[model samples]
Target: MPYTTAPVLPPGTLSRSPQPVLPTGDGLVLRPWRGRDVAAVHEAFQDPLMHQWHIRRSDSEAEVAGWIEGWEKEWEGERDAQWAVVDADSDRLLGRVALRSIHLVDGLAKVAYWTTAAARGQGVATRATATLTRWAFEEIGFHRLELLHAVANEPSCRVAEKAGFALEGVKRSAALHQDGWHDMHLHGRVRGD
Candidate 1:
Protein backbone atom coordinates (compact mmCIF):
# COMPACT_ATOMS: atom_id res chain seq x y z
CA MET A 1 0.00 0.00 0.00
CA PRO A 2 1.11 3.57 -0.53
CA TYR A 3 2.27 5.56 2.45
CA THR A 4 -0.64 7.27 4.17
CA THR A 5 1.51 10.12 5.34
CA ALA A 6 4.08 12.52 3.93
CA PRO A 7 7.52 11.43 2.93
CA VAL A 8 10.30 11.88 5.43
CA LEU A 9 11.94 14.11 2.87
CA PRO A 10 10.18 15.90 0.03
CA PRO A 11 10.82 15.06 -3.61
CA GLY A 12 12.85 18.16 -4.43
CA THR A 13 15.04 18.11 -1.35
CA LEU A 14 18.31 17.13 -3.03
CA SER A 15 17.60 18.50 -6.46
CA ARG A 16 16.73 21.97 -5.19
CA SER A 17 20.38 22.86 -4.81
CA PRO A 18 23.66 22.01 -6.37
CA GLN A 19 25.78 19.41 -4.65
CA PRO A 20 27.46 21.07 -1.67
CA VAL A 21 31.00 21.22 -0.43
CA LEU A 22 31.10 20.08 3.18
CA PRO A 23 33.78 20.99 5.65
CA THR A 24 35.36 18.57 8.05
CA GLY A 25 36.33 21.47 10.36
CA ASP A 26 39.73 19.91 10.52
CA GLY A 27 41.93 19.41 7.49
CA LEU A 28 39.64 17.91 4.89
CA VAL A 29 36.61 18.81 2.82
CA LEU A 30 34.10 16.91 0.76
CA ARG A 31 33.61 18.55 -2.61
CA PRO A 32 31.82 17.64 -5.76
CA TRP A 33 33.88 15.35 -7.94
CA ARG A 34 35.74 16.98 -10.80
CA GLY A 35 36.70 15.60 -14.18
CA ARG A 36 40.34 16.18 -13.26
CA ASP A 37 40.06 13.60 -10.49
CA VAL A 38 39.95 10.71 -12.93
CA ALA A 39 43.63 9.89 -12.64
CA ALA A 40 43.60 9.92 -8.86
CA VAL A 41 40.51 7.74 -8.69
CA HIS A 42 42.12 5.33 -11.13
CA GLU A 43 45.16 5.13 -8.92
CA ALA A 44 43.07 4.55 -5.83
CA PHE A 45 41.38 1.62 -7.53
CA GLN A 46 44.79 0.20 -8.36
CA ASP A 47 45.37 -0.55 -4.68
CA PRO A 48 44.77 -4.23 -4.04
CA LEU A 49 42.92 -3.49 -0.83
CA MET A 50 40.43 -1.25 -2.66
CA HIS A 51 39.98 -4.04 -5.18
CA GLN A 52 39.47 -6.68 -2.49
CA TRP A 53 36.77 -4.73 -0.70
CA HIS A 54 34.95 -3.10 -3.59
CA ILE A 55 33.47 -5.48 -6.14
CA ARG A 56 34.33 -3.20 -9.05
CA ARG A 57 37.49 -1.29 -9.88
CA SER A 58 38.16 1.45 -12.37
CA ASP A 59 39.96 -0.17 -15.31
CA SER A 60 41.05 3.14 -16.82
CA GLU A 61 40.82 6.89 -16.45
CA ALA A 62 38.03 6.84 -18.98
CA GLU A 63 36.01 4.56 -16.77
CA VAL A 64 36.68 6.74 -13.74
CA ALA A 65 35.55 9.80 -15.70
CA GLY A 66 32.42 7.96 -16.64
CA TRP A 67 31.88 7.09 -13.00
CA ILE A 68 32.21 10.72 -12.06
CA GLU A 69 29.76 11.65 -14.76
CA GLY A 70 27.36 9.06 -13.46
CA TRP A 71 27.70 10.54 -10.01
CA GLU A 72 26.51 13.90 -11.32
CA LYS A 73 23.58 12.28 -13.08
CA GLU A 74 22.65 10.32 -10.00
CA TRP A 75 22.80 13.46 -7.91
CA GLU A 76 20.28 15.06 -10.21
CA GLY A 77 18.12 11.97 -10.08
CA GLU A 78 18.26 12.08 -6.27
CA ARG A 79 19.37 8.46 -6.17
CA ASP A 80 22.90 9.18 -4.99
CA ALA A 81 25.19 11.91 -3.66
CA GLN A 82 28.95 11.61 -4.13
CA TRP A 83 31.87 13.75 -3.03
CA ALA A 84 35.58 13.72 -3.42
CA VAL A 85 37.27 14.06 -0.08
CA VAL A 86 40.12 16.49 -0.61
CA ASP A 87 42.85 18.03 1.45
CA ALA A 88 41.89 21.52 2.48
CA ASP A 89 45.27 23.04 1.88
CA SER A 90 46.41 21.18 -1.18
CA ASP A 91 43.08 20.25 -2.79
CA ARG A 92 44.53 16.83 -3.44
CA LEU A 93 42.09 13.97 -3.72
CA LEU A 94 42.34 11.89 -0.62
CA GLY A 95 39.30 9.70 -1.12
CA ARG A 96 35.56 9.62 -1.75
CA VAL A 97 32.39 9.70 0.36
CA ALA A 98 28.85 9.08 -0.77
CA LEU A 99 25.27 8.43 0.16
CA ARG A 100 24.07 5.65 -2.11
CA SER A 101 20.70 3.98 -2.51
CA ILE A 102 18.91 7.07 -1.33
CA HIS A 103 15.19 6.77 -0.66
CA LEU A 104 13.55 10.16 -0.34
CA VAL A 105 10.25 9.07 1.13
CA ASP A 106 11.92 6.83 3.66
CA GLY A 107 14.64 9.39 4.34
CA LEU A 108 17.22 6.67 4.28
CA ALA A 109 20.47 6.05 2.42
CA LYS A 110 23.55 3.88 2.54
CA VAL A 111 26.80 5.51 3.48
CA ALA A 112 29.88 4.59 1.48
CA TYR A 113 33.46 5.81 1.44
CA TRP A 114 37.08 4.99 0.72
CA THR A 115 40.39 6.67 1.52
CA THR A 116 43.56 6.53 -0.47
CA ALA A 117 46.36 4.24 0.65
CA ALA A 118 48.37 7.15 1.98
CA ALA A 119 45.33 8.80 3.57
CA ARG A 120 44.24 5.69 5.41
CA GLY A 121 44.80 5.64 9.18
CA GLN A 122 44.73 9.44 9.20
CA GLY A 123 41.00 9.59 10.12
CA VAL A 124 40.04 10.78 6.63
CA ALA A 125 37.15 8.35 6.30
CA THR A 126 35.86 9.06 9.76
CA ARG A 127 35.99 12.80 9.30
CA ALA A 128 34.34 12.64 5.92
CA THR A 129 31.63 10.32 7.17
CA ALA A 130 30.89 12.50 10.15
CA THR A 131 30.74 15.62 8.05
CA LEU A 132 28.47 13.95 5.54
CA THR A 133 26.22 12.58 8.26
CA ARG A 134 25.66 16.01 9.68
CA TRP A 135 24.75 17.38 6.28
CA ALA A 136 22.46 14.45 5.54
CA PHE A 137 20.52 14.85 8.73
CA GLU A 138 20.59 18.57 9.36
CA GLU A 139 20.42 19.93 5.86
CA ILE A 140 18.84 17.17 3.79
CA GLY A 141 16.30 16.09 6.44
CA PHE A 142 17.18 12.43 6.37
CA HIS A 143 15.89 10.35 9.23
CA ARG A 144 18.41 7.55 9.11
CA LEU A 145 21.60 6.43 7.48
CA GLU A 146 23.12 2.98 7.31
CA LEU A 147 26.63 1.81 6.68
CA LEU A 148 27.63 -1.68 5.70
CA HIS A 149 31.04 -3.16 5.23
CA ALA A 150 32.56 -6.57 4.95
CA VAL A 151 32.91 -8.20 8.35
CA ALA A 152 36.64 -8.52 7.88
CA ASN A 153 36.98 -4.80 7.22
CA GLU A 154 38.03 -3.69 10.67
CA PRO A 155 39.11 -0.25 9.57
CA SER A 156 35.69 0.50 8.11
CA CYS A 157 33.99 -0.70 11.26
CA ARG A 158 36.14 1.68 13.25
CA VAL A 159 35.26 4.51 10.89
CA ALA A 160 31.56 3.80 11.35
CA GLU A 161 31.84 3.99 15.11
CA LYS A 162 33.97 7.06 15.01
CA ALA A 163 31.42 8.70 12.76
CA GLY A 164 28.66 7.88 15.30
CA PHE A 165 27.06 4.88 13.64
CA ALA A 166 26.07 2.07 15.97
CA LEU A 167 26.81 -1.56 15.30
CA GLU A 168 23.40 -3.01 14.50
CA GLY A 169 24.18 -6.57 13.42
CA VAL A 170 25.75 -8.69 10.74
CA LYS A 171 24.36 -9.78 7.42
CA ARG A 172 25.71 -13.20 6.80
CA SER A 173 27.20 -13.83 3.36
CA ALA A 174 25.86 -10.51 2.24
CA ALA A 175 28.56 -9.27 -0.11
CA LEU A 176 30.58 -11.03 -2.78
CA HIS A 177 34.20 -10.03 -2.85
CA GLN A 178 36.69 -11.21 -5.41
CA ASP A 179 37.62 -13.99 -3.04
CA GLY A 180 34.09 -15.16 -2.25
CA TRP A 181 30.97 -14.34 -0.30
CA HIS A 182 31.66 -12.46 2.93
CA ASP A 183 29.61 -11.61 5.97
CA MET A 184 28.80 -7.92 6.31
CA HIS A 185 28.64 -5.69 9.34
CA LEU A 186 25.65 -3.38 9.42
CA HIS A 187 25.82 -0.11 11.32
CA GLY A 188 23.27 2.64 11.54
CA ARG A 189 22.60 6.14 12.89
CA VAL A 190 19.29 7.86 13.18
CA ARG A 191 18.52 11.54 13.58
CA GLY A 192 19.73 12.83 16.93
CA ASP A 193 22.07 9.86 17.30
Candidate 2:
Protein backbone atom coordinates (compact mmCIF):
# COMPACT_ATOMS: atom_id res chain seq x y z
CA MET A 1 0.00 0.00 0.00
CA PRO A 2 1.17 3.47 -0.84
CA TYR A 3 0.30 6.94 0.39
CA THR A 4 -1.34 8.76 -2.51
CA THR A 5 -1.93 12.47 -2.66
CA ALA A 6 -5.46 13.80 -2.78
CA PRO A 7 -7.06 14.40 -6.17
CA VAL A 8 -7.15 17.96 -7.41
CA LEU A 9 -10.45 19.67 -6.78
CA PRO A 10 -12.77 19.90 -9.80
CA PRO A 11 -12.63 22.82 -12.20
CA GLY A 12 -15.46 25.13 -11.18
CA THR A 13 -15.04 26.96 -7.92
CA LEU A 14 -16.97 25.26 -5.14
CA SER A 15 -19.19 27.37 -2.94
CA ARG A 16 -17.95 25.48 0.12
CA SER A 17 -14.45 24.72 1.23
CA PRO A 18 -12.77 21.59 -0.15
CA GLN A 19 -13.36 18.41 1.81
CA PRO A 20 -10.35 17.22 3.75
CA VAL A 21 -8.98 13.68 4.01
CA LEU A 22 -9.45 12.33 7.51
CA PRO A 23 -8.19 9.29 9.43
CA THR A 24 -10.37 6.99 11.45
CA GLY A 25 -9.50 5.22 14.73
CA ASP A 26 -7.78 2.17 13.24
CA GLY A 27 -5.51 4.17 10.99
CA LEU A 28 -8.07 3.92 8.21
CA VAL A 29 -7.88 6.98 6.01
CA LEU A 30 -10.83 8.22 3.96
CA ARG A 31 -9.64 9.83 0.77
CA PRO A 32 -10.53 10.08 -2.92
CA TRP A 33 -10.20 7.12 -5.28
CA ARG A 34 -7.16 6.68 -7.48
CA GLY A 35 -6.34 4.81 -10.68
CA ARG A 36 -4.39 2.19 -8.78
CA ASP A 37 -7.49 1.42 -6.72
CA VAL A 38 -9.38 -0.15 -9.64
CA ALA A 39 -7.89 -3.61 -9.08
CA ALA A 40 -8.66 -3.58 -5.36
CA VAL A 41 -12.14 -2.30 -6.07
CA HIS A 42 -12.73 -5.04 -8.62
CA GLU A 43 -11.48 -7.63 -6.15
CA ALA A 44 -13.78 -6.34 -3.45
CA PHE A 45 -16.65 -6.37 -5.91
CA GLN A 46 -16.16 -10.07 -6.49
CA ASP A 47 -17.16 -10.81 -2.90
CA PRO A 48 -20.65 -12.34 -2.70
CA LEU A 49 -21.71 -10.02 0.11
CA MET A 50 -20.67 -7.06 -1.99
CA HIS A 51 -22.77 -8.29 -4.87
CA GLN A 52 -25.76 -8.83 -2.58
CA TRP A 53 -25.37 -5.45 -0.93
CA HIS A 54 -23.97 -3.16 -3.59
CA ILE A 55 -22.79 -3.94 -7.12
CA ARG A 56 -25.22 -5.32 -9.64
CA ARG A 57 -23.92 -8.31 -11.62
CA SER A 58 -25.11 -6.69 -14.81
CA ASP A 59 -22.21 -4.31 -14.31
CA SER A 60 -19.97 -5.26 -17.24
CA GLU A 61 -16.35 -4.43 -17.80
CA ALA A 62 -17.38 -1.41 -19.84
CA GLU A 63 -19.62 -0.21 -17.06
CA VAL A 64 -16.79 -0.54 -14.54
CA ALA A 65 -14.53 1.32 -16.90
CA GLY A 66 -17.16 4.01 -17.14
CA TRP A 67 -17.32 4.16 -13.35
CA ILE A 68 -13.58 4.61 -13.06
CA GLU A 69 -13.83 7.31 -15.68
CA GLY A 70 -16.55 8.98 -13.67
CA TRP A 71 -14.36 8.71 -10.60
CA GLU A 72 -11.87 10.97 -12.29
CA LYS A 73 -14.65 13.28 -13.38
CA GLU A 74 -15.93 13.43 -9.82
CA TRP A 75 -12.48 14.26 -8.58
CA GLU A 76 -12.31 17.09 -11.11
CA GLY A 77 -15.50 18.67 -9.65
CA GLU A 78 -17.65 17.51 -12.57
CA ARG A 79 -19.46 15.10 -10.27
CA ASP A 80 -20.07 14.28 -6.60
CA ALA A 81 -17.09 13.36 -4.49
CA GLN A 82 -16.35 9.70 -3.70
CA TRP A 83 -13.62 8.02 -1.66
CA ALA A 84 -11.63 4.86 -1.16
CA VAL A 85 -10.95 3.66 2.38
CA VAL A 86 -7.29 2.76 2.88
CA ASP A 87 -5.33 1.52 5.84
CA ALA A 88 -3.02 4.21 7.15
CA ASP A 89 -0.51 1.73 8.54
CA SER A 90 -0.27 -0.72 5.64
CA ASP A 91 -1.83 1.53 2.99
CA ARG A 92 -3.95 -1.41 1.87
CA LEU A 93 -7.38 -0.84 0.36
CA LEU A 94 -10.08 -1.98 2.76
CA GLY A 95 -13.29 -0.61 1.22
CA ARG A 96 -15.12 2.34 -0.20
CA VAL A 97 -17.53 4.90 1.27
CA ALA A 98 -19.20 7.69 -0.62
CA LEU A 99 -21.70 10.51 -0.33
CA ARG A 100 -23.75 10.09 -3.46
CA SER A 101 -26.98 11.63 -4.80
CA ILE A 102 -25.65 15.01 -3.83
CA HIS A 103 -28.18 17.81 -4.02
CA LEU A 104 -26.43 20.98 -3.04
CA VAL A 105 -29.58 23.05 -3.30
CA ASP A 106 -31.46 20.72 -0.98
CA GLY A 107 -28.50 20.34 1.35
CA LEU A 108 -28.96 16.60 1.27
CA ALA A 109 -26.95 13.56 0.17
CA LYS A 110 -27.05 9.77 0.46
CA VAL A 111 -24.21 7.83 2.06
CA ALA A 112 -23.43 4.33 0.81
CA TYR A 113 -20.62 1.96 1.70
CA TRP A 114 -19.31 -1.60 1.76
CA THR A 115 -16.32 -3.28 3.40
CA THR A 116 -14.17 -6.15 2.24
CA ALA A 117 -15.22 -9.45 3.81
CA ALA A 118 -11.82 -9.62 5.44
CA ALA A 119 -12.52 -6.31 7.14
CA ARG A 120 -15.91 -7.23 8.58
CA GLY A 121 -16.51 -7.27 12.38
CA GLN A 122 -13.60 -4.85 12.78
CA GLY A 123 -15.74 -1.71 12.90
CA VAL A 124 -14.44 -0.53 9.50
CA ALA A 125 -17.84 0.46 8.17
CA THR A 126 -18.84 2.17 11.40
CA ARG A 127 -15.68 4.26 11.60
CA ALA A 128 -15.77 5.09 7.89
CA THR A 129 -19.41 6.11 8.12
CA ALA A 130 -18.72 8.40 11.07
CA THR A 131 -15.72 9.98 9.38
CA LEU A 132 -17.58 10.58 6.12
CA THR A 133 -20.68 11.89 7.90
CA ARG A 134 -18.61 14.40 9.82
CA TRP A 135 -17.00 15.47 6.55
CA ALA A 136 -20.40 15.83 4.88
CA PHE A 137 -21.79 18.03 7.64
CA GLU A 138 -18.70 20.05 8.48
CA GLU A 139 -16.69 20.21 5.26
CA ILE A 140 -19.48 20.02 2.69
CA GLY A 141 -22.00 21.84 4.90
CA PHE A 142 -24.76 19.36 4.16
CA HIS A 143 -27.83 19.69 6.39
CA ARG A 144 -28.93 16.10 6.08
CA LEU A 145 -27.41 12.71 5.23
CA GLU A 146 -29.30 9.49 4.62
CA LEU A 147 -28.26 5.86 4.93
CA LEU A 148 -30.55 3.23 3.47
CA HIS A 149 -30.22 -0.52 3.99
CA ALA A 150 -32.24 -3.52 3.01
CA VAL A 151 -34.12 -5.11 5.92
CA ALA A 152 -32.23 -8.34 5.44
CA ASN A 153 -28.86 -6.70 5.99
CA GLU A 154 -28.52 -6.80 9.75
CA PRO A 155 -24.84 -5.95 9.73
CA SER A 156 -25.43 -2.80 7.68
CA CYS A 157 -28.25 -1.73 9.95
CA ARG A 158 -25.93 -2.17 12.89
CA VAL A 159 -23.33 -0.06 11.14
CA ALA A 160 -25.87 2.71 10.70
CA GLU A 161 -26.87 2.57 14.35
CA LYS A 162 -23.27 2.59 15.50
CA ALA A 163 -22.60 5.63 13.33
CA GLY A 164 -25.28 7.68 15.14
CA PHE A 165 -27.79 7.60 12.30
CA ALA A 166 -31.38 7.47 13.57
CA LEU A 167 -33.67 4.81 12.21
CA GLU A 168 -36.14 7.12 10.52
CA GLY A 169 -38.46 4.47 9.12
CA VAL A 170 -38.78 1.57 6.73
CA LYS A 171 -40.31 1.65 3.30
CA ARG A 172 -42.31 -1.47 2.61
CA SER A 173 -41.42 -3.13 -0.68
CA ALA A 174 -39.21 -0.14 -1.40
CA ALA A 175 -36.69 -2.04 -3.50
CA LEU A 176 -36.43 -5.29 -5.36
CA HIS A 177 -33.76 -7.64 -4.15
CA GLN A 178 -32.59 -10.63 -6.14
CA ASP A 179 -35.40 -12.87 -4.89
CA GLY A 180 -38.17 -10.29 -4.73
CA TRP A 181 -39.28 -6.94 -3.37
CA HIS A 182 -38.05 -6.16 0.13
CA ASP A 183 -38.36 -3.47 2.76
CA MET A 184 -35.67 -0.88 3.25
CA HIS A 185 -34.68 0.85 6.47
CA LEU A 186 -33.96 4.51 6.01
CA HIS A 187 -31.63 6.06 8.55
CA GLY A 188 -30.85 9.73 8.83
CA ARG A 189 -28.51 12.07 10.67
CA VAL A 190 -28.71 15.83 10.49
CA ARG A 191 -26.16 18.39 11.42
CA GLY A 192 -26.82 19.80 14.88
CA ASP A 193 -30.01 17.83 15.21
Candidate 3:
Protein backbone atom coordinates (compact mmCIF):
# COMPACT_ATOMS: atom_id res chain seq x y z
CA MET A 1 0.00 0.00 0.00
CA PRO A 2 2.95 2.24 0.51
CA TYR A 3 4.18 2.15 -3.05
CA THR A 4 3.00 5.14 -5.07
CA THR A 5 3.96 7.55 -7.80
CA ALA A 6 5.84 10.76 -7.24
CA PRO A 7 4.17 13.83 -5.81
CA VAL A 8 2.38 16.31 -8.03
CA LEU A 9 5.22 18.81 -7.90
CA PRO A 10 8.92 18.16 -7.53
CA PRO A 11 10.61 18.99 -4.26
CA GLY A 12 11.12 22.71 -3.40
CA THR A 13 7.86 23.91 -4.93
CA LEU A 14 6.03 24.40 -1.65
CA SER A 15 8.85 25.54 0.56
CA ARG A 16 11.39 28.24 -0.07
CA SER A 17 14.82 27.10 -1.36
CA PRO A 18 16.26 28.75 1.71
CA GLN A 19 13.73 29.48 4.41
CA PRO A 20 13.11 33.21 4.58
CA VAL A 21 13.06 35.41 7.67
CA LEU A 22 9.78 37.29 8.19
CA PRO A 23 9.56 40.41 10.25
CA THR A 24 6.24 41.58 11.75
CA GLY A 25 7.29 45.26 11.62
CA ASP A 26 6.75 45.43 15.36
CA GLY A 27 10.05 44.04 16.64
CA LEU A 28 8.89 40.47 16.17
CA VAL A 29 10.95 38.26 13.86
CA LEU A 30 10.04 34.88 12.45
CA ARG A 31 13.11 32.82 11.61
CA PRO A 32 14.27 29.27 11.24
CA TRP A 33 14.60 27.13 14.32
CA ARG A 34 18.04 26.60 15.85
CA GLY A 35 19.45 23.89 18.10
CA ARG A 36 20.09 26.47 20.79
CA ASP A 37 16.35 27.14 20.94
CA VAL A 38 15.68 23.83 22.66
CA ALA A 39 15.66 25.34 26.13
CA ALA A 40 13.29 28.15 25.24
CA VAL A 41 11.05 25.86 23.24
CA HIS A 42 10.88 23.43 26.11
CA GLU A 43 9.98 26.17 28.51
CA ALA A 44 7.33 27.61 26.23
CA PHE A 45 5.59 24.28 25.81
CA GLN A 46 5.45 24.02 29.56
CA ASP A 47 2.82 26.74 29.47
CA PRO A 48 -0.62 25.42 30.29
CA LEU A 49 -2.15 26.98 27.18
CA MET A 50 0.17 25.00 24.92
CA HIS A 51 -0.67 21.78 26.72
CA GLN A 52 -4.36 22.48 26.57
CA TRP A 53 -4.51 23.16 22.85
CA HIS A 54 -1.60 21.35 21.21
CA ILE A 55 -1.74 17.58 21.13
CA ARG A 56 2.03 17.15 20.88
CA ARG A 57 3.89 17.60 24.11
CA SER A 58 7.63 17.68 24.83
CA ASP A 59 8.53 16.59 28.33
CA SER A 60 12.29 16.78 28.09
CA GLU A 61 14.93 18.87 26.38
CA ALA A 62 15.82 15.95 24.14
CA GLU A 63 12.27 15.77 22.87
CA VAL A 64 12.26 19.50 22.22
CA ALA A 65 15.56 19.25 20.36
CA GLY A 66 14.19 16.50 18.18
CA TRP A 67 11.23 18.70 17.37
CA ILE A 68 13.57 21.44 16.25
CA GLU A 69 15.49 19.02 14.05
CA GLY A 70 12.25 17.89 12.42
CA TRP A 71 11.61 21.43 11.27
CA GLU A 72 14.66 21.31 9.03
CA LYS A 73 13.61 17.98 7.56
CA GLU A 74 10.16 19.42 6.88
CA TRP A 75 11.71 22.30 4.99
CA GLU A 76 13.99 19.99 3.02
CA GLY A 77 11.05 17.89 1.89
CA GLU A 78 8.92 20.94 1.19
CA ARG A 79 6.30 19.42 3.42
CA ASP A 80 5.89 22.43 5.65
CA ALA A 81 7.51 25.57 6.96
CA GLN A 82 7.98 26.48 10.64
CA TRP A 83 9.50 29.51 12.25
CA ALA A 84 10.41 30.55 15.72
CA VAL A 85 8.71 33.80 16.64
CA VAL A 86 11.27 35.84 18.46
CA ASP A 87 11.71 39.30 19.88
CA ALA A 88 14.17 41.20 17.75
CA ASP A 89 15.36 43.38 20.59
CA SER A 90 16.54 40.57 22.89
CA ASP A 91 16.31 37.48 20.68
CA ARG A 92 13.86 35.97 23.12
CA LEU A 93 11.38 33.33 22.11
CA LEU A 94 7.85 34.61 21.75
CA GLY A 95 6.19 31.66 20.10
CA ARG A 96 6.01 29.66 16.86
CA VAL A 97 3.98 29.70 13.63
CA ALA A 98 3.88 27.24 10.77
CA LEU A 99 2.25 26.18 7.57
CA ARG A 100 1.25 22.52 7.92
CA SER A 101 -0.26 19.93 5.65
CA ILE A 102 0.76 21.90 2.61
CA HIS A 103 -0.72 20.41 -0.55
CA LEU A 104 0.79 21.78 -3.71
CA VAL A 105 -1.72 20.15 -6.01
CA ASP A 106 -4.54 21.89 -4.23
CA GLY A 107 -2.50 24.99 -3.49
CA LEU A 108 -3.79 24.80 0.07
CA ALA A 109 -2.18 24.82 3.49
CA LYS A 110 -3.04 25.05 7.16
CA VAL A 111 -1.61 27.56 9.59
CA ALA A 112 -0.85 26.73 13.20
CA TYR A 113 0.54 28.94 15.93
CA TRP A 114 1.24 29.28 19.63
CA THR A 115 2.37 32.12 21.86
CA THR A 116 4.27 31.98 25.09
CA ALA A 117 2.34 33.12 28.14
CA ALA A 118 4.42 36.28 28.44
CA ALA A 119 3.82 37.23 24.84
CA ARG A 120 0.05 36.77 24.77
CA GLY A 121 -2.30 39.77 24.51
CA GLN A 122 0.39 41.74 22.70
CA GLY A 123 -0.78 40.81 19.16
CA VAL A 124 2.19 38.50 18.65
CA ALA A 125 0.13 35.70 17.15
CA THR A 126 -1.82 38.09 14.97
CA ARG A 127 1.28 39.77 13.67
CA ALA A 128 3.09 36.50 13.04
CA THR A 129 0.09 34.97 11.31
CA ALA A 130 -0.35 37.99 9.09
CA THR A 131 3.29 38.05 8.11
CA LEU A 132 3.38 34.33 7.38
CA THR A 133 0.16 34.51 5.37
CA ARG A 134 1.53 37.24 3.16
CA TRP A 135 4.77 35.36 2.66
CA ALA A 136 2.99 32.13 1.77
CA PHE A 137 0.55 33.78 -0.59
CA GLU A 138 2.88 36.19 -2.36
CA GLU A 139 6.32 34.62 -2.12
CA ILE A 140 5.45 30.92 -2.06
CA GLY A 141 2.46 31.18 -4.41
CA PHE A 142 0.02 29.29 -2.26
CA HIS A 143 -3.57 29.83 -3.32
CA ARG A 144 -5.25 29.43 0.04
CA LEU A 145 -4.36 29.29 3.73
CA GLU A 146 -6.54 27.97 6.52
CA LEU A 147 -6.51 28.15 10.29
CA LEU A 148 -8.47 26.03 12.73
CA HIS A 149 -8.81 26.17 16.46
CA ALA A 150 -10.99 24.77 19.15
CA VAL A 151 -14.16 26.81 19.38
CA ALA A 152 -13.40 27.50 23.01
CA ASN A 153 -10.15 29.26 22.16
CA GLU A 154 -11.41 32.79 21.72
CA PRO A 155 -8.00 34.38 21.63
CA SER A 156 -6.96 32.24 18.69
CA CYS A 157 -10.18 33.04 16.86
CA ARG A 158 -9.43 36.69 17.42
CA VAL A 159 -5.95 36.24 16.03
CA ALA A 160 -7.33 34.61 12.91
CA GLU A 161 -9.76 37.44 12.37
CA LYS A 162 -7.16 40.10 12.98
CA ALA A 163 -4.87 38.37 10.51
CA GLY A 164 -7.55 38.69 7.81
CA PHE A 165 -8.72 35.09 7.79
CA ALA A 166 -12.47 34.94 7.41
CA LEU A 167 -14.52 32.55 9.46
CA GLU A 168 -15.62 29.81 7.15
CA GLY A 169 -17.59 27.56 9.45
CA VAL A 170 -17.36 25.17 12.36
CA LYS A 171 -16.56 21.48 12.30
CA ARG A 172 -18.50 20.01 15.13
CA SER A 173 -16.54 17.73 17.46
CA ALA A 174 -13.71 17.79 15.00
CA ALA A 175 -10.74 18.01 17.33
CA LEU A 176 -9.67 15.81 20.21
CA HIS A 177 -7.88 17.46 23.09
CA GLN A 178 -7.23 16.74 26.74
CA ASP A 179 -10.84 17.64 27.43
CA GLY A 180 -12.01 15.20 24.81
CA TRP A 181 -13.67 16.03 21.51
CA HIS A 182 -14.06 19.73 20.91
CA ASP A 183 -15.75 21.61 18.13
CA MET A 184 -13.37 23.46 15.82
CA HIS A 185 -13.87 26.68 13.90
CA LEU A 186 -12.22 26.95 10.54
CA HIS A 187 -11.08 30.26 9.15
CA GLY A 188 -9.50 30.75 5.77
CA ARG A 189 -7.95 33.30 3.42
CA VAL A 190 -7.51 32.88 -0.28
CA ARG A 191 -5.06 34.71 -2.47
CA GLY A 192 -6.25 38.30 -3.05
CA ASP A 193 -8.83 38.01 -0.29
Off by over 4 Å in 1: none
Q: What is the lDDT of residue 143 in candidate 3?
A: 82
lDDT for 15 in candidate 1 is 87
The alpha-carbon lDDT assigned to residue 42 of candidate 1 equals 95
lDDT of 3 by residue, 20-106 (tens): 888888899999999999999999888888889999877999999899999967887766889999999898999999999988766
Please write out the lDDT profile of model 2 over residues 1-193, one tens digit for every residue: 6327432232242424444577986689987676777667777777878767663653455566667677656644524767778898887888878877776656777888888878899889899999989877776567889999998999999999999999999999888766788899999998985
Instruction: Give the Å error, residue 134, model 1.
Output: 0.7
Q: Give the clashing pairs for model 3.
A: none
lDDT of 2 at 6: 32
Residue 162 alpha-carbon offset, candidate 2, angstroms: 0.6
Error (Å) of candidate 3 at residue 18 is 0.9
lDDT score for residue 141 of model 2: 66
lDDT of every predicted structure (CA atoms) = 0.94, 0.77, 0.89
* TM-score per model over all chains: 0.98, 0.84, 0.93
Q: How many residue pairs collide in each prediction?
A: 0, 2, 0
| Candidate closest to the true structure, highest TM-score | 1
